[model samples]
Target chain A: MVALATQTISSMSNTDIEIVVDDPTAPEENSPAVASTRVVDIVVSLLLLALAVTLGWDNWRTGASWDSTGPQPGYFPFYLSVILGGASLYGLGAAFVSRREATETFVTRAQLRRVLAVFVPTLLFCLATQYLGLYVASFLLIAGFMRLVGKIALWKSVLTAFVFTAVMFVTFDIVFDVIMPKGPLEAALGR
Target chain B: MEAFGLLLHGFAVLLTGKTLLLMMVGLVLGIFVGVLPGLGGPNGVAILLPLTFTMDPTSAIVMLSCIYWGALFGGAITSILFNIPGEAWSVATTFDGYPMAQQGRAAEALTAAFTSSFIGSLVAVLLITFLAPMISTFALKFGPPEFFAVYLLTFCSFVGLGREAKHKTVISMSLGLLLAGVGMDTVSGQLRMTFGSAELLRGINFLVAVIGLFGISEILLTMEERLALRGHAAGISLRVVLSVWKDLPKYWVTLLRSSVIGCWLGITPGGAIAASFMGYNLAKRFSKDQESFGKGRIEGVFAPETAAHASGTSALLPMLALGIPGSGTAAILLGGLMVWGLNPGPLLFVEHKDFVWGLIASMYLGNVVGLVLVLTTVPIFASILRVPFAAVAPMIVVSCAIGAYAIQNAMFDIWLMLGFGVVGYVFKKIGIPLAPFTLALVLGNRAEDAFRLSMIGSGGDMKVFWSNGLVGTITTLAILLLFWPVIDKALTSVTRMVRPAKA
Candidate 1:
């Protein structure tokens, strides 16, 4: 069992080589790093490599060679996928070679927290838009962000959200008459 | 003279009250978007594009082009007063502009920047007026091989000229091409890479990608940085404008050189950001007082602003003439043209003469109106930046969401936008150039089709790209450009070796 685990680890390291080192210039920060640049680089390049392989395989499946009509549908994309794979390999190799960037912080603990603070809410807003509709979702998003993240007074946040939503409704629905996702509230207040 | 007569007829068509009103409205909206962080010319136009969907093509093009002009002018405001570049092209403007603002010369710097932009745009418009017809006529002779060669040249130029890593650029561009391939193949009637999703079958929309990449990614990036905006108060009066105009003639050579650089980059795909930096660098190299440039020299302000505006304006020429966009915003405009049921190649000149001329005429009129509006309303617009970024951030996000959904009126598009937003953020962080990615996405299928058509015609002969002088020259030039970095290095090394031996 121990021998098998050691062999598997060696194979994994050989396949996706990554070098982690300490940066001489990196500041001793309290926030700490969420991940090193080398790790992110390795992961991203590997993802790109996987994408290229999948695309290449799919294109090949769909007839990449030339036929009676000149070229097959997958001919161009297959070649493009080959180029992509080559580029991804170059990126992966560069990441492993470049020692200076290896130890660099991709993002700090605090920074990632802040990024997630916005990203999470935005994702929720998008999800909310599906059911609550655009206007209500927008109102909740604006008001909630301002109140929770921005730390504005409740009244002020509510007022700003209300006015903004009203203007959007007037502009998109009434003035321009562009169709948007409507919820029960909009349906209830029918023309 | 014939072009001039058509231009006058175009002016007549654009002089209507409704069109004029729309122009002003577009300009104001454009300035608002430009002054705000996380929003810019390309996505600004993208957001407003759906609004123009129902309008006449001429009026719609006029409004959109005016927004382009307005965004160009508005970028200088933030660069000069706030020391924060509102657009990528305006980053160089802050080198001297902010220092001038610190010395209480904000109004003068503003005037010079605005005036230089006007002159640059004026020159670009004139270039378009004369050159558009000639280029389109030339393009009329192009066949599939020639078209493929041109597209090859366009993509190769990005690799050759772009400052980003060559591997990264290749990756980004190839990724875009792959994304463009994610629908049913038009030629073979075979599904390419839909992954069994009905939504993917319709293909990824460039507009949605642009909004997410530019708009949503910008907000996320801004979130990473502390978003505090403090700007100098700009109060430009008639006297300030006049005084700046008097000093401007002293730097006429700088202005002229920058404009020329801008026009060249614009006509090519070097883009406005590259043009601005080149303009600034060239001006500094030629100036007698180079040391004073970063220390508050007005010439420093003049060089970049002029080049950026000139490049931005003239980028439309290729889009009009060759159906190839020279910049990102121009790509969006090209998309708008297609959405309007107007084919955008050489035939556009022959088929929609009125629409073509009217847009050109609007370019001239719009710049004049934009100059006056931006100069007089600088204070009001600058104050808009005073709004807390917290409030402004959410508003911009909401606008991006609305714009994404409005593209196809589908909820899936909104989700796709969010996905692209994350992708864009990561791409930007990793030093991959977004412009080539966008250009590839927009032009991918067309280039592929042209390639396949050429192959069909030549019975799969690889020499078809070099079969004719025109196609051969373009293909050879593209190959040369693709290896430009290597050639450039070799030439420098050879010169160094020879010089030492001679010594």
Candidate 2:
């Protein structure tokens, strides 16, 4: 039993080690990594603050007053806006205070590059669904993501993307009977 | 006799072909996810929750809970085999488990850990079966104030017991509460945080946030460093498993003790991690060969595994009896209960006896199935490590995208998932605990609802939480937990100062 337990634990550990090794943290802080992380934090915090302010302004302009009802529709949300705004401000403060001392940042350029590569394509895919319809846009989106982010060979990327899109289309549309958005492009293609 | 009859009815439901099939399926999928590093039990359940929408509620929950058990069992496999823990709870196992593997006694350690996990889960299940109804009956007297106090207690205990900095945990929890304030106020259909976008009206789905935090973030983190997939050369044999039975008797006492510790910790909010840590410490102190613990002692592997499994299973008890989830996974199960149109409160057992009993019965069946499935597949799961990271990374990402998209079939969820991925990455960078964030998100809405309802009932007076006897007791507990850290820190500092003076 002891040997069996040892073997089981060892096998599991080996797999975990391989996974952990991929992004093993350095025992000592690296200056470049630290600077990169701090910059990302500052930028993201600012973006969030801008979003909160814009949303708060929009809600204020709308005829929907927060006090219309016993508690207005915006009553709870107004508080959230303030809280989010506060959190972003705090994040900004931390970033600024830490910036003076050339401390290590968490976000590296490489990390940002990787994040944007996938994030941008995904955003575009969502937008495309509005114009190109679900199937056509999905195919294009997947193909684009594969080619750009995955760096697969053109043919392989196209084939894989197309196959996945087709399967999803069939599964959701045919099997599940859920209607998907079809854009002018899809209509023209007779899809 | 009445309880026995109900259990029989439960057995009848569990014995059905559908329930049995789902139990097996859940176990297999759970083991697969659990064996993978970066995918812990909660993540595994969240990733697979979408698949259950098409099934009956009882069957779906059975499968999900079974998957949870399987994941727990599967976690130790990697920890022992390669010194890698698939989950944080399994970290202790790697200390001694991997060393035992290095000594070529891998099969012995695997069997013992697996058996101990089984024993722990089974013990907890039995306790739940007998104790749940009694607790629910006692809880039936609670009103909104009591419920709110319970939530406060939960929050306080989690903060008090948390390993992370208290300030960070509070911040994360407050963020969750702030997010919960986004959707429409339940009492008065007024929109709270929509700003102007129609999409914001629904607020952020807990499932989406979870997928983003645990799944997408995991993918991004993996991309930072190039992971190598190395396979183990040795295979576990049945003969080896059986031969270790003789030594098992020596560890039986430790297993029982750890199981008790696991149960106690699991019952308390934020106790799972503490329970495992306590079990490990106790085991080390009690062992004769304590010096060999971190090096390769079998007791090291045995203690934590037993405690983790026990705590994980016991968390379900409070969820069933009190309508309060003890962990993120239980919170999801609570969502499942709501989707099934069954409210999980004191009335759950009385009003939906069949559902409650059937679920209990399924736990019994599912645990056995999980143990058998995980033990047999140890070698097969270990081989997955041989797959190249280049291939595995993309697959994981695709699965994450699919899981996110499946939640509400809304394009916005995918975007939300990406945003969460970014948050997850930042949290990782800052060394913030993701567990608290996830837990806060799961419990935040319920806490807000209880708080608002309690205040409304009391005419907006905060004193309501302390007015009733039951509520007062709970409030006192919450207050104590809230200030525990200050007391502990002061004591620790005083001790430090006094030690030198005494010397």
Candidate 3:
């Protein structure tokens, strides 16, 4: 994606015109079917508004009542929700009226791939921790990442992960005497 | 005599076998991480902080402070050899240091930078040891108003003094403040922006944010670029290193000037980058052979190296004495102090004298170790640039994730780490200054809490802040800082108008 952007920028630099002309070679950069900035702004604003209303309503029902001495549990949060909703609406209006050209979108397809590469594994690690315990889950996570992302050999990845997790276990569990969460794997091991 | 006695006692603690061993380990680790491109001082310290969690406060600080020194020394190695600065402060060094290296003067440039860094850090450490107590005593005069003013000054200086556009810096700072407003409100115990998520109740940890922004984001950026792999073929000799001393006297004036600029900027929260840039420009302007500066002038390399180390070291003074961190690394150190259950204000010296003094003593010892270690291992560390990005990038990500999780042993923080990683990537893409944002995030909640407490103590009378002389002085300085750009522009125009007429 960066290569494409760089190519487009370099080609544009070589042009004689003062204004930016569409480069024929870069299809994505020159595409005319892209979503309008106003449409995105409105959709994001509405989603935020729904979130604010839901949270504010839930707090009003479940949160602590106000006392004369000070604020209630939901006092500060409820107000913040309102402000967030209001600001989002303001953004929506600004996007609607602004005559400036639509800027580039933040989350392109390439950017999404980058985000998912880290995010998916992290999600799996969190779920795996409950069943395998912190140490085991972290070991597997590290080994898998080393093999998959780092492209290391199987034995090397396994060895590195084992050493890393073992050192952490020794330091935190034995030395610090902090209790780690024991899951089914530890229970089955009976130690 | 009393200060000398206390320092001796501090040394007594620092010289113990356990403390010395940990300090040495930290120094080596710091140098290793600092020499690696994109993994500078803050990331190095954050990655290693969890290791010291079980140790006593004094020993932990000794290790961490040594790590800080080692990282400062390590940054110069890559700057001189590879033309890739390990830290932003080392950017100036690449102007001349890399040129010298290309000309087969790599050993001399490395030696000059190492010795100058040693001298600069030594001066700053000496100042901290003697002057910290006095600074702490004076800092007792500050209330919330003064602290608020200082925080404002810190933000403004980054905006005003930075090379980036002011609007972008302000946006980053506001984003940080918004992030800081998450979690429960201190006064009311009311959640602010948690959105009913239990993890958000505790707020985002500063370490997690820093690791994600500086560490993980850097790795991702490295992955995007097709970096040229440079081979390490040259070896530095002791004789060539020793020859740097011959040119030392010629650059002593630049060294002194850079050191002063470093200390002043370091104290005021302007940080190492500002000090180094200013020092580099000043040295170039004053040099007899200005044309040779960017090509391969020894003085060009010496000035920034001295100022960067000096400023980086002196930033600790405000952090230790006043609970005010003057740079990103110092902010991480402040977070470390908090994790060790030690508050960093005026009373830290009184209540935790051994820890404070021991840390100060370790700074001196660590500088010596850092200089010797980095000078000896420059060739080996420069080889790190030859390693494939794919192999190292994932390791960086894993280290940062683990570091974040270790902070609270919570899986939720790992997610926050990823979120911050995305924020960092966006900030970089949009040309926003991440340093100011990180600085504000570190100081925001503390500033808010102080402000609230002060107002409550003063019976909600805002006049109380202005009535206090010290607070008033700081507040005035902050106001002046806000208008500094306008003032500077007007002054420059007047000087230009007057000079032409006089001529």
DockQ of each: 0.20, 0.18, 0.09
Residues B1-503 of candidate 3: C-alpha lDDT, one tens digit per residue = 56677888888988888888998899988887887765889988887787788789999888888888888888887787767788889999999988987787777788888898988888788888888899898877777777776676677777667666555565566556556667887776667667788988898788889888887677555443334434222455678776787768877899999988888889877889988988899999998888999898888888998898889999999888888888889988898998988988888988998988888888888888777777666655555554434345445665676677778988777677776776676567545678877877777677766665566566666675676777777667776776778889999999999999999
Candidate 1 CAPRI assessment class? incorrect
Q: For model 1, how does the per-residue alpha-carbon lDDT over A1-191 read when each residue is reduced to its tens digit?
A: 00001112232222221111111222235778888887887888999999999989999999999898899998999999999999999999999998966778788876677677778888998998899898999999989988888776789889998999999888888888877887888888882
Local accuracy of candidate 1 as per-residue lDDT tens digits, B229-299:
45555568799899998887899999999999999999889999999999999999998888999988899
lDDT of 2 at B432: 52
Alpha-carbon TM-score of each model against the true structure: 0.94, 0.84, 0.82
Q: State the RMSD for candidate 1.
A: 10.7
Comparison by TM-score, 2 against 3, better one: 2
DockQ of 2: 0.18
Clashes of 1: 0
By lDDT, who's the top model here?
A: 1
Local accuracy of candidate 2 as per-residue lDDT tens digits, B391-425: 34444554565566676777777678778877887
Candidate 2 vs candidate 3: which has greater lDDT? Answer: 3
